[model samples]
Target: MNSLTRWVRGPWTNPTASGLLIALAAIFSFTEGVNPFSDGHAEGAGALPAALIASDLLMVAAAVVAGTPILIKAVRALMTKMIAIDLLVSVAAIGAVVIGQYWEAAAVTFLFAIGHALEARTMKKTRSALAELVAVAPDVAVVMRDGKQVEIPAAGVEPDETVLVKNGAKVPVDGVVIGGTGALDESSITGESIPVEKGEGDEVFAGTISGGGFLQVRATGTGADTTLARIIHRVEEAQDAKAATQTFMEKFSAWYTPGIIVLALVAGLVTGDAVLALTLLVIGCPGALVVSIPVAIVAGIGRGAKDGILIKGGEYLETSARISAVALDKTGTLTEGKPYLTDVTVLDPALDRSDVLGWAARAEAGSEHPLARPIIDAAEAEGLPVHGLPERTEPVVGMGVIATLDGQRVSVGNLPLLTVEGIADDSGAATEVDRLAGLGRTPMVVTLDSRVIGVVAVADRIRSDAQEMIARLHDAGVQKVVMLTGDTQRVADAVAAQVGLDEVRAQLLPEDKLTMVAQLKADGYTVAMVGDGVNDAPALATADIGVAMGAAGTGVAIETADIALMQDDLLKLPQAVDLARRTVNVMRQNIAIALITVVLLLAGVFAGGVTMAIGMLVHEASVLLVIVNAMRLMRRNEDQHSAGPAPASDARELQTAGAGPLS
Candidate 1:
């Protein structure tokens, strides 16, 4: 029975099904020759109309047979406030038939159901994009230990354990590379068109593709701590959030439906015309009124999906549209969040670049630091031969690396290491290193035989998409976009300017970000903060909306966020806002049209200008009108106008298409 029920209620619930029944009934009605008008005599003129009404009634019966469970569920939901408007609309539809406006009632019910099914189908399509993303998350991880490989549950992986990631495998945890190198496909993570090269010590997000070489990664974060997990969680939370428009509609329906019924009853009593009363009832059904909000919501969600934005629910969709300001956390939001080999300065003119890089990679090997990874990667790429250290290496926390190579003392770190070791200042090397560091670069100092030889400057590269996304947001409706970073002001400003951000707040701690967000709120602005680190959790919680970049299936909890823009693509933020705004506008238009139709139809009957049959016809027409109008949401892309010259060009192209060749 469950299988049968599923079959009947599945893809079969569509307008085409109802339309077929309606068509069949119309044919039967044409054969009957009954009058459509109540005033027509039974002999000739009325037979066709009467037959038509009978046909419509047959179609309605067919619909009730097919939609029995839906009707029951609608009733149950309304009783429980699970679904409000659908319940009242269903009841009103039945009341129209009980009052003898069979065709009017059937038409209203059929149209409403069809519209709902369409809305559901469209919404499902829109939501499928996120489902696709969810489907890609790895359920298992490959753990490597003591030269053996083992597959384990992704959630079971622990921090600091080496995990073997092979080609095409989804990263199961956030970790830094310890061995091997590979090209990673991060399109899903960053929304960029290119793949990124990663090597030892470079941090890779869970769920991104390790495209080529095998890698051994030491897991730093797992389970709910992964960025991807946080994104999925945030998306779900956002979906559950409600918007003001939905709330108003619920409140309106509570009184609106009952009021219509009472007005119809009053009209019936005063006019002493039962048929006129029935027409009033038919007009007051609110079929279109019930369909308005959901259709717009479905359409908005669909639009977001097309642009790679996944908004979990209508509530998040609504809130995104109302945000006034957006706060971007610098580390991963505006910058690449990975160190890249930006520059190499050789102080000892005789020291070959390749040799220096190889020494640096071997010296920094096994260190879980961002700067070390790029140096190692650069050495490997240059095919520089790296030899194992002759003696054990000691790590100076917050300083650098100290080791012995070929029985000679060697240290590669920062200026602090030289100052603390009582080594000669080497003013030339110090000045050059300071210049590089000042430009947002991390300078790795190399010391051989107790003297500084060279400095290799590495910096976290800015993400290719960051600047474009920021500009897109401004174009899409964001009033201002700002970057907040813990990095030096010079580094933050450099990245911010390149990314087209309106402002920058640099050298701020996680707490500082929270304070800044609070101040913005105090200023009466709605702020959306985007971040993807544990340090960002508090600010994410405090902002008007928190967007976590867990597109790679890492970082699963964004408890503070009202809306979670699931993918790392910052552009989705702007796309979602536009989708929300357009959806609200469509909903408003639908409600207005539905309300006006009901009011005008009731006025006609009360003024004695409309008969029961005319009232029913007009009432059904309004339902049809609203259904057609709601369908217009599906075409919103055509109606969507860009802000400037782009839309003008589109308009011209549209004009050309419309003009065609001269007839």
Candidate 2:
């Protein structure tokens, strides 16, 4: 019995079946001298003939084949005391058939069925990005167990287990490399096509493909616990959640279907015209209204996902479009989070460059500050002797570090540490600090036996694309670009000038950064705060939109940020803003198209020019149009606006003004 029911309902779901039925019905109607396009005026010319009996039988078969699903769905809805578009369509088609309008009945049901099939097909295309993501989910894992390679289901791998990733293989779990080296094509997670080099201690995500080279990774997360899983979960949730406009449209549709039925009954009773009543019911299917917002939201969000930009939901997309000011953290956002040794000034010409650098490297050998890496790395690179850790080390909370090496007191820190240590600057060390600061370098004064020796400076390199990103933001309609940092005023000013930031807030603690974001919101500016998502959590939460950069490897950032950029590229930021604006525009345009179609169709029905068949055709056409309009978002290159390059004079002026504050 179940097989029989499936066979019966299959024709209703297939567009080819409906098309064949419509073709057969047209042939029979033409041979019997019944004009299917007469708009229901054939009632006067119709006559029963023995030869025309075949045409009536064919029309009845066409109606049954095309209307079965609608009738079944309407019956189910009626059992639940709900009125839907299917119920209205079923009533109209069945009523036309009962009133002896065979051509009208066949045309209405066949057109409705074919239209629904087309809508479903086009709607799937709008969601193709998400479908592609699901298709790429890893299935198998190669693990090293009992000293032998074992193949198992990806979900069966235990945490902390060693997994072997081979060339051109999909990584089965999120893990940290423990041995060997390779480049990974992280496009699945980060949307970057360039392969990223990975080595010992570098994190790799599941679903990424290893480019050439072997690697032994210690699994940190497996199955649904991986970052890829979180991104997939978030994207599915975002697509399923309803926007405010969608909620309104759903409620309106609920009332619309029932209201159409009531209007049809009243018009039939008062005017005594059954054709007019059925025509009203046919036109009021709510076809376009029900799908307008969801189609646009799905397409827009899916497009973002394909590009490695994960927007939280439709509501966030709407908010991102109105962003006027963008707040960026200086250290990890605008500048490379890693600092490098950029300048070395010898205050005492008597001491050589190695002597000055060796002392600073020795003092910093025991410290683990971010700025310490560049100094240590430079010392090691130049073959300076930094053999072992210092004997004793004390970190001054806000200043620097004091280390005792071989019972010799060595202090390396800013001028504040010198003041606290009572070291006089009669050697003109302060002059060197100011000069390095003017160039955007973090200057540290090295002291030995309470005497200033030399100054060592480390500066965070400005990203090559930083200026271009800021310029693109301006082109994307951003009113102001501001830099918020905890660095000293002079250092912040220099970096800000180099990047062309309109405003700079330096020496900010974490709480101070949060307050600055709140102040911007209070000032009525729609602000978007971009950060690395760890130390900047508070400010990120306070801003209108929190953007997490390079979030593919971090689960927390993927779940928390309003917008997560999978890669660490500054250019994706402006691309996200542009996408959001374009998506919201599409949503608004779709809604307008849907509503306008309904009003015009309703007006045509009352004017007595539209028949039941014509109304269904027009209604179906509008739904297809709305879906096609949303599909426009699936194509990249919707908006080609980009901030090309910064002018040389503008860059020079910023550098000049930026240097003045530090000098």
How large is the C-alpha RMSD of every model relative to the true structure? Answer: 10.8, 3.9
Candidate 1's C-alpha lDDT?
A: 0.65
TM-scores of the models, in the order given: 0.68, 0.91
Q: Best candidate, TM-score-wise?
A: 2
- Tens-digit lDDT string for candidate 2 (423-495): 7663888888878778777778888878888988876667777888998899989999999887778777887
Q: In candidate 2, which residue ranges exceed 4 Å CA deviation?
A: 1-14, 39-47, 75-82, 638-663
Give the runs in model 1 whose Cα sits over 4 Å from its true position.
Answer: 1-34, 42-242, 302-308, 347-369, 379-426, 429-431, 444-452, 555-568, 603-663
- The per-residue C-alpha lDDT of model 1 at residue 553 equals 41
User: What lDDT does the true structure give each of the candidates?
Assistant: 0.65, 0.82
Residue 165 error, candidate 2, Å: 2.3
The best candidate by lDDT is 2
